[model samples]
Target: MFAVPALSGADDGSWMEVRSADSRECIMAEQRDERLGRRRLHLRLRFLAGESTGSYVTRLAARNNLPVEGVLRSMGIGPMLPVEPQYTEMYLSRYARERLANLAGYTVAEMQKRLVGLRDEFLMSDGDKDDWEWPWDARAGYIVQACSLCAAQRGTRSPAWLILPDPWHVCLRHHRWTDNSRSTQHPYIDLSNLKDVVRAQQRLNRLGKHLGPAARWVFADACSILVRSGYLEDPARTEEWAALAKQLGEQRVRPLAQLSRLSLLTQDLAWLEVRRLYGELGQADYREWLERATRRHGFTFARPLKEWHSQHQPLSRGIPELFSDQSPPSNVVRRATGHELPSCLAAVEELSCLPWVRLPNTMDRLFL
Candidate 1:
């Protein structure tokens, strides 16, 4: 039988619940280390989905009324110092992961599913001790709070934090706006009154699913256009977001609140670019289409159309080069030369250098 360590705290019994019904067998068969006298904690906390390993440790410490450092030490994490899960990440060594999984009454596979930092790519195999570390470059991603309502439903007393990826700041279920900043003061903004923002998140989800890898390029290009046009900072362009901020009692609009508008604008711009490239629209025709598309999406370009063309001249000039050496495959040629264009841009690597273009074989039907 596995030995279970007695926990010292006011009894709540919530942590005793198994994370999943299927994990019951795995929990029951947990083993003890006779030599080290290592055992599972009597209270086993549920891991929040997409939770950072550091955040899980924090919640575990809070639930058992133990110091965060103490919990890390118990999991064989050492040289223990203060751990700020919201602002930093913790990478677990292979051995340390085993010990932590044993302590928490979970199998390694079970922990991997819920802990974002516990993935194989993030794990530290050379070291024995788990340590707080970040492996990515300066601005890859950041940790943010998980949905509060979702946490409460999971029976957590303290807030749970998540290592959210780009284009995933909004919690569709709770209508909360989560951000990638280090500040803990306002981790999530309530978007109960902002139905447009909620709809925008849904649209973003669809765009991601529909376009696959190409969605990233579309989103980045859209953001660049908006920033260049001063839509984010210009008062005239930010009226909707400003009103949303005021309703939420914030001094200024949060950039994330404009995601809904951004999503629409992204779709418009992506569709226009595809049409300009594949339809072989003339310069004047392309300019007219660009004007109509931007106006339809409520974006007023700060610069003249000629200036914009000069900046993105490569997109207009590179078509002949793309097909010069070898003609595009029959299907692609048919789609491009036909009167009715395909709903989305074809997945081709040659166009990758251009803004809002997709990579090879990653295309799907876009709604627009």
Candidate 2:
């Protein structure tokens, strides 16, 4: 369950897993082909070998007296890979999969089943091979780091990184809807701030029971819109909530607080409103626009998203904007049939195999 150093390419990458065998802790070794030849890598690990939930990077950095990012680069994996771990599969070849299975004690059948399971989870067509890949879009658009609580349950504060394709605020078994990664830099938004949001998340999960994962994108966009309104508030739209924000101020409420307070029926109503109004929206591509818009206006996700969405209640009418704080034009068009056209909200002229993370830009800002 290590995020460590992963490599992403359209093709040509290999990886192996070495687990504790007794704990939830594990390590991943990755390799990518370079023009100079395959890059050699050996993360400095303290203690010859033992069962521990400590981060290999953290320990490796400690052993070699280097920062985690430097150690990752030494391994030929991008420093950002730890934050977006699953991108490794972008270049992970079939040969790599078979090799990894052999190392992890999983049979070929088991590995095939895992791949099949991921496909089923994403509802991708099975017959597409050379042309098939996980729809990294239609997802929360960030890597899933270790669950702090799950790790604590097993006795360690170190990260136990895992993949969460649609982390749409639903964790029935764990009874939590937020990412509890123990990252000091880009930790998750604290869920304890608004308990009602957790309930709303449960309702969203129920919506998923019928609508499936597509509903997740809908709800996520709604939250994104709600969060965006806090910074680039539309006066006409938020007239009703203006007083509330003044009353609660920035400290007393979260931009998403209103979404949490919505009744179950209203939550469904809002989801419907979002689906109908959105027409065609890509939740995967918007955060960059949101981040840039906020930065241009001198605000950060922490400032507004952590404060309040200008609108006190969900709108009954009007199509929601996927990547902007402003409303969409009246003549906005949609793709033919039921297909969704890609969005350039973030100016994706040069699309990379690894989708830039969709979280708020954390480059200089603390929350990406």
Candidate 3:
């Protein structure tokens, strides 16, 4: 029997009593909730590197942050015990949970019940036992973890549980209607959690600042948001974009041309900028388009520094030499210096191979 320390600060509190040595009672309420089928328990814990009891307590705590004495007081745990403290602190996950629970001063059972309550309120309702896990299953865990990862990577407060996990999965039903990326995760419930996931996705996209797939995702998500919010009708904007994309693909025209035409038609200035920044257009073509855009729609021509850099940056800089062939690099057409390089050219030395991709008569290496 181990004794928990008495509280130094005196104040009337409701959770200070437990029966002192009953493991079952420590989380009995949660077990009951699980048995009742109202909620499912997910315990997250971090334990001291190699302690047993500490590990167990950590597990319990992770499931719900509960104070040690409060957890044992009503449970009849002894005030003092003969067990070595080191022996109790060895389970990794278990200790993690216990630490969480202790910090929050909540017993396993109480936290379980609360989670059940949350499920009842937030999860989708289905009439079957197995089907009832909507929006909060293992996939939900993946989404949450994804959110955590995005938060760590991007430093945003977006909800992770609604977005797809690594490898970027999406439901066919949801993604097929538009240009959104397809995810491999199935049986998605696009309930409230999806909003949080989008927030995280948007945050990460912003952090990426129009680089790699991050910029693409941001663009896609913005379109999706407009469609979902009824600002743009379903299949209308996407339909228009698709139609233009198809026309361009059939004609072997560039993607920017397609995007710019669609943006002009849709009255979305942002998309027009997207087309300009991501189109890999030549300086002459860009100037022509800028003039055309301003004449047709009174659009401004200022380029943000980040957007300019993304459009004009060299593709061979950070891209691994091996994978550069799989996709055409964005920096092939340098917007800033009006210099264009061969699409596959990796070095200034390669410029001599194809003089047409460079200035008409000059052989100097041009920085974009």
Which predicted model would earn the best TM-score? 1
- lDDT against the true structure, each candidate: 0.54, 0.35, 0.29
Show where candidate 1 strays beyond 4 Å: 1-39, 125-139, 166-168, 180-187, 235-252, 269-292, 298-368
TM-score of each: 0.61, 0.38, 0.21
Which residue window of length 10 is worst by lDDT in model 2? 344-353
C-alpha positional error of residue 118 in candidate 2 after TM-score superposition, expressed in Å: 7.9
lDDT of 2 by residue, 48-148 (tens): 11111113234434444555444443323221323222222222234333332343345546544433322223333334322112233323223344445
Count of residue pairs whose backbone atoms collide, per candidate:
0, 3, 68
From the highest TM-score down, the ranking of the candidates is 1, 2, 3
- Output the better candidate (2/3) by lDDT: 2
lDDT of 2 at 315: 33
Cα RMSD to the true fold for all candidates: 12.7, 15.6, 21.1
TM-score of 1: 0.61
Over 1-368, each residue of candidate 1 has an lDDT whose tens digit, in order, gives 11223444673442232233323221111222233316777677876777778788777766766666556545543333334565556787776677778777888898887775776777776753233343332122346667878888776856677764442357888888765443346656777887877887788778766544445555555655555555555422457666655654332244554465578866765554444544455667656765676566553553432333444322443233222445345455334322122122222222223333221112111111
Q: Any idea how many clashes model 2 has?
A: 3
Candidate 2 root-mean-square deviation in Å: 15.6
